[model samples]
Target: MPNFPNIILFAIPFFILAMLVELFVTAKQHIKSYEMKDSFSSLTMGLGNVLLGFVSKALVLWAFLYVYDHFRLATIPIIWWSFVLIFFADDISYYWFHRVSHTCRLFWASHVVHHSSKHYNLSTALRQTWSGSFYSFIFWIWMPLLGFHPAMIMLQMSISLLYQFWIHTETIDKMPKWFEAIMNTPSHHRVHHGSNPLYLDRNHAGILIIWDKIFGTFQLELKDEKVVYGLVKNINTFNPIKIAFIEWIYLFKDVLTGKKSIKNRILYLIKPPGWSHDGTGKISNDLRNEWLIKKKTYDTK
Candidate 1:
């Protein structure tokens, strides 16, 4: 496996400092941004993710190396041009991984930990998945096979992660119109975090907002519809352990007990969240369509 300085370790102080600044600003501005128990739960989840990452990352590196050693098309040199390419390459990979995580129940089981918090603040960014590193690497493993060095792929991944931390806060509002058009800003991410029917599963960008716009998953933050941060069905708990693993618990329970058919059981894993064997449960698109129809009717009235 290739070696690179772990950029995330160095960013720890910056993360804490930024959170403190945001906490102070929100309090002074009289914005209800952070909750004591909620922020604490997010911090605890972040700590667990870092701890679990030690083992999970080792496995990821091994897999990347295995593929790179055997199947690489060509050895891409780590020059300036390569870095430029990998930035976009890794980000698009993140776009797809994030999009899939929202649309597939198996991946969502881990990704939901980040959205479990009802409070959207700097601390909310720290609410990462303990299980994601184990399986999420599958999304990025192709980079190595494409001849991008593991070290380059890993560095860009960290850079992308670092860039995203700032966008989690509600402190900074909109960026310049041009910047907002091209890059992911707090405004864009706020919609991503929102549980509103119109906002669910939208804006799955990593660093660039362009992918969402290109892919038709983009939903602008509406002035009238305030973004509500949390799951459509909030977990209603501050326990970090529960917040991290509750979706997995629910997912397996649904598969094991509710349905008897093997196809239905498999669908419970592959299908989006809120998908049901019967025509009862509703996913994000379902809820969004219903809300849009009602809004259209009200507007005409």
Candidate 2:
């Protein structure tokens, strides 16, 4: 198998070229506005993500190779079926990982970077988490333990991620019902990026849309409903360091300064983003009320 770095080197240029073509083709339709601030942040975050992925691949492979050698299981040949199984297994793992990333404070710290973009475009897709590897490795460890070769696990995951890149665009509005029903498409992903009340965390599929539909996280795009992208309380800063650590720092501060109850403290760590001690933070009833009022105004107009 080619080195992972080589694969990334080959893919990055092609991906960028494709994104540029999409941007040029769609620029005339006024589909969405590209915020320069968010676009630069997205590019930086994407590079960070690639770095984290490289590090993670090295670590996971080291662990797997050591364990396999120690246990005399290194002789196992790479099974082609592992690739097939990985497609499904990786998606299932990604579903849970994505859901948890949104729900858990520590995980959300990294995942929020991707959601920080206020625009939905190919560039927004490139806006990835710099620290996602910290928790994401937990999901894929099962692949090796289940007897899948480490090399195959890495390859399939890369391909899965590649498949996901195209879905980030707004250029392709809605696909056929069958495709939207089973797979994650641009429409499904647009809903996921939306900060609208109806769309929050609605589509968590990695490769397949079935998980969201089956688990009740699925939502359809309503005609004439415009999506408001970005978090309830936008970060409003461009510092990459702050973008990565601000939520985490806040989480720790809340854990230390707030209630003493173990359950409440744990809840602070595991609750939805912007959840707080008094239940009155940014994502609180206040924001929801404002959103509702604005929505009503839009409806009446």
The TM-score of candidate 1 is: 0.98
lDDT of 1 at 281: 98
Q: For each candidate, C-alpha RMSD in Å?
A: 0.9, 3.5
lDDT string for model 1 (200-284, tens) is 9999999999999999999899899999999999999999889988999999998999546999999999999999988799999
* Best-matching candidate per TM-score: 1
* lDDT string, candidate 2, 57-164, tens digits: 678777765554454432435556655767898889889888888767778877888888778788887887766765577877766666666676677777778888
Supply the global lDDT for candidate 2.
0.77
TM-score of each: 0.98, 0.86
lDDT of every model, 2 decimals: 0.93, 0.77
Best by lDDT: 1
